[model samples]
Target: MNYFGLNHKRNNISRDSLLLEIYTMNLPLYDLTLIVPTFNRQSFALRNMRYWSGRDIVMHVMDGTKLGLTPLQLAQLDDNIHYHHMPELSIGERLNEAIDLIETPYVTFLSDDEFFIPSALSSCISQLKADDELVSCMGLSIQFEYKNGNVIGRRFYQSLENYSLLQTDALERMLAHMDPYVMSSMNSVVRSVVWKRSMRLLCIGDLSTFNIGELLFELAVCFQGKTKVISEIMWLRSYENKIIIDHAKTKSFFIWWRSDDKSEDRSKLLSCISSILTKTSNEREMVKSFMLLALNRYVNTYDKIIIGKDFFNDIIVKIWLLIPNNIKNILRLVLKPFIKFNTTNLILLVAKEWSHEGVKTNFIELCEIEKVIQYFYKVEK
Candidate 1:
């Protein structure tokens, strides 16, 4: 392992000893504890578990529900997978619990609605073993949309796959401003020991936090360490109509109205960034500079205006007057019919509209789009 500079502490784990540990536990062991935390979405989780079973992957499915499984699904679960129920935990808490039961050296949290490709785990393991310094590794995640039991999708959701594998130091600098890689507990695999170190940082003063949970864990693991990113798609994430999404999109300014305070969330995020900034002089500037750029994009991409007495309606009305009157009227007319259609139909219509602007090139570009279709077709690993 490349234990340079700050990672010198890991030098105690010599190559021979580490190799012994690996060999004793079956060197380069493919064993992985797939920790999945699920709520009422038992059906989706079950299907996802079944998909992973083809790879002979060990699973630790944690049910964050009080009622346990709906009898039928419980009876249907494969014996190879272990299922446990714990309703008194948040997603992050459940993840911590699941990781505790993992006997393998590596673990990857897989969300119930998300799916993994066949070779995703194998690829991730190879990258990690090849680069002994990598604290963790992640691969590309192409987005897909499903409708009416039929799947349809689009690729390069935000062009994240455009970038290549990043060094831990470089990624930390970037994350100081805005996270380049999306923050999700389920997207990547990490060394069990690294995760255990992170769990300590995640829980502060015996009071566990939730919203910034995964972000904190990622920051801790990547702190002055190495990380790898496989360009190949590994995870398939689905964000249909989740409650977390609803919470994040809140526009209400009533500070007391929220169940959880966001002040902590903002503080934890800033702290993580500030820690990274202190690492290097050049990195400090890069992090702050990129953060500003991301903030601007965030404002532009997600704009909502609220007017008095319109608590329930969309805030898009406020921007309508800014456009030329003729174009505004034209949009209103065109959008009315589109709004009447179902979300899937509307997405297809919009996708067709944007298809002309797509930058189609060679196999790589085609591969990108095909990957999206693969996710929809359950081909993603």
Candidate 2:
């Protein structure tokens, strides 16, 4: 650790700073780096960068803007942030450049318009250091919208309180659920080494597709080990319909399905599925449950099929053949009803009746129940 702005290692540290140090250990021990990739949100970029100036951090803005900074403004920010102006680059290229320049052991990206919580970095870094197996940590996302002059704050995931990554064996049960875990790029903090490896995987896929980076990233990191959830709303994800892609948030799913990329994507995904299945003692049941979750999400929205039905069905059958008869019967009873429901109703059912407990506990609870009729029936219109 650099020990740049911190007190002696043995001294009692303040709670906030202790949290900061905990978050810091996972990264390389120098000052942290915040990579902001901006297209035209100059003002937002400036404001967000200013918030981190005095902290033990450096801000690098990959400006994809045509306008150059004046000598006066550049000199003023010289002490705070490094401005890399390149109006010609795409978002992906700009991000890649930022990735190359980061010298910190930890690297995280924030949008020009999105604001992070004051202690977000500290919390995530702290959690990472405390758990050696935790490859990455992400804060919860809360959406606060200003519509018709009203400000409404809608919280998505809870703040990470006691949640940390479990062993790989435990992760198998977690990933089988419908909403396994969310990978929010905005609020996630990763070890420098893991980030680099995941980035290499992302680069293999087309950057233009929505979530192409995220999808590949989640698969790579999850395969290595468990990822912890902090549950804090470190990020405020703004609503942008155009930016939301089918699989990820990109131009088209075809970008992931292009002839040259298909085999690679398919192989990577299947490998992930196979690895996940291999670790489980109840492989067939787990596979069926995974399929039920996938089909539920797909039938809820045709978009889920973008990965291709053949690919999807193949995995389902493989899982089915591997699972025990008892497990398959249980999943069918649990998921078959919502299999044909419309998206709106399906979502309502999930919110109303789905398990409030985390994935692991919920799955265990399912086994104890003689029948889940109380949780499944009587859906509100």
Candidate 3:
């Protein structure tokens, strides 16, 4: 197994063994651990198990689904795999619990349907190990969906290709993170200390509403130190709409923002971030301002993807609802040209070169991960 685990710096090793160690050290092995909190998605879980079983990295698969794998089924997995069947816990709770179990110095999260490129992950780990200031590091991420028997893919967070949170001050880091909040670093390879602290507060402070939990995580990471997004492809995102929507059953962001206790959630979020920032009352106000800035910027940016959440609440929406289903389809086709900005536009067609998951393409960079993306998009079989 290629073990990229660092810290073998003893003065006793021979040159040849040390060279092999150097070769092995290029891969992220025991130094990094993946926290996969899956809920009611055993197929994805099993696919994940199959993918990671051969790797040398440690994976804590905390399955929150009612049905978990049998003992016989678990026996097939590698010893590096640790499975926890916590059917009763929520995702946040599971994350909170899982963080404590991480023995590795570095940690990162993966959605049930997502996959990380091992080489890119190694790159992230290398950056983290090299730089004490970097609390989080990741490569580019691309979203993929199946169509016409091909794995169609595109870069969703291209802005992040050059993004890095290198601000020295905590509040400055927070402010800089909000301006173009293209994606979350929660999934990025983070130092275990930051990951645990952020996740603990994320759970206890109840920052789950109004995307507050997300803000808490990003803030906590950047609050500690720097965050880097490299040029390599890091995440393979599954944009299967049915699978994506199935997981988004929580209160919609608009509904939660409009809720009566929004302020309470906000204050709780403040406390969560403050736990990491540990700033004065006036500085805490700065964090609050940052949260508002992030919320407004985030809402304005992604509200178009809300589908009907904001518009359905409007009284004029009844006029939109009155249109016949057939007529609505025709209108959508007619207005498609005018509707320049929407979620559908992001779902562009991926080409044949991109379909080769294991091989390197001119654009898409997920390589050496043979047949991994096909786990979710099984159009081949």
Candidate 4:
């Protein structure tokens, strides 16, 4: 058994007591609900959920796939696991549905291909229960590339490595710093009340606008209360070729902005910003900072191809007009290397390397890929 110890100062319960509770299964140590939303990935979901089936936590599986697990199969897992089949609903709707059934005070979302470290979840629960002011908490996720049921490479996702609090002015500073990977459902745990309120504020839109909705909810949580960022890498994310290919193709600025469907999504994001800004003076400034960060994210998606082209007719250009010259200069300086050189093509090269499975790989190559992943979040910090 791999037992991990928590910092004694963070929790009132002793390590021996917690371990005894976990081993004896006679008492519940925390109030946490782990939600796994699965769609057409039964094998992946089942493989990952099996690890948690014997645990004391409440694990809810919202299955929306064409061929999901049967009740018999679910029963085989454990009594602690709850299975809900809602095949007609989308991922976002399934998540909302699962949220409605949560009886725990703290809730966390897990994807079919993500796994949590046992000690990390317990540590986060301890921290959240220790601090009533904290609305959410998360740790870094380590991403692994897999092919033919074999792990090819591993790297940490864009994540921080130090314990930090995002409250008061720190919230604005973190949002302004704008780490796009910082706010993912797979890597976060939030208070149920905060999650409920934030979800209610999300705009009803097409599934393509799901990311926008999630971002708004995360921001609302951060704005409403403090957020604890744990530096430990406590989650494992499985990366497949289809995801990389789709991301490479869809993340292009021209492709994302030129789509007719995205126009409505953009408008909805702006509307969300408007609604959030109406709350308080500090929140208004924070929302404005988030808007600038969002713009920078969109601009950063522009690779070498679109960076040189004139986007005079683009709606995003109007947004660029709203940013102050100082920030605009900073963005330009940040993106200049990619725009002027062939550095942006490194993504394609990495993708190509992954295409050749089981090829001889080195630590340096993996580190290069890690750098590319971190580039999205690197700012003048």
Best by lDDT: 3
Candidate with maximal TM-score: 3
Q: What is the lDDT of residue 11 in candidate 3?
A: 19
Ranking by lDDT: 3, 4, 1, 2
- Off-target runs (Cα >4 Å) in candidate 3 are 1-26, 241-265, 276-370, 373-381
lDDT of 2 by residue, 1-381 (tens): 122232223223233443432322222224457778787667656655555554466778889888966666566554558888998877777776777787877777777755445455667787778888876777665444333322223444443434554656533523432233445433477777667655554544344444555555564565455677654435654432135346445435534444564766644554444443345647635543443344244233444444477688999899889999999779777987667321222211222222232211111111111011111122210
Q: Which ten residues in a row have the lowest lDDT in candidate 2?
A: 361-370
| TM-score for each model | 0.56, 0.55, 0.69, 0.60
Off by over 4 Å in 2: 1-31, 145-152, 157-165, 169-181, 184-186, 205-211, 239-381
Q: What is the TM-score of candidate 2?
A: 0.55
lDDT of 3 by residue, 315-373 (tens): 55778789899998898889887863223222212312222333222222232232354
Better of 1 and 2 by TM-score: 1
Q: Estimate the lDDT of model 3.
A: 0.67
Where in model 4 is the C-alpha error above 4 Å? 1-29, 145-153, 163-165, 170-174, 177-181, 184-186, 199-203, 207-211, 244-381
Candidate ranking under TM-score, highest first, comes to 3, 4, 1, 2
lDDT of 3 at 315: 54
Model 1, 250-308: lDDT tens per residue? 33322322327665654454445544435576765554444434433333333432232
Tens-digit lDDT string for candidate 4 (116-151): 655566666777889888777776655655433223
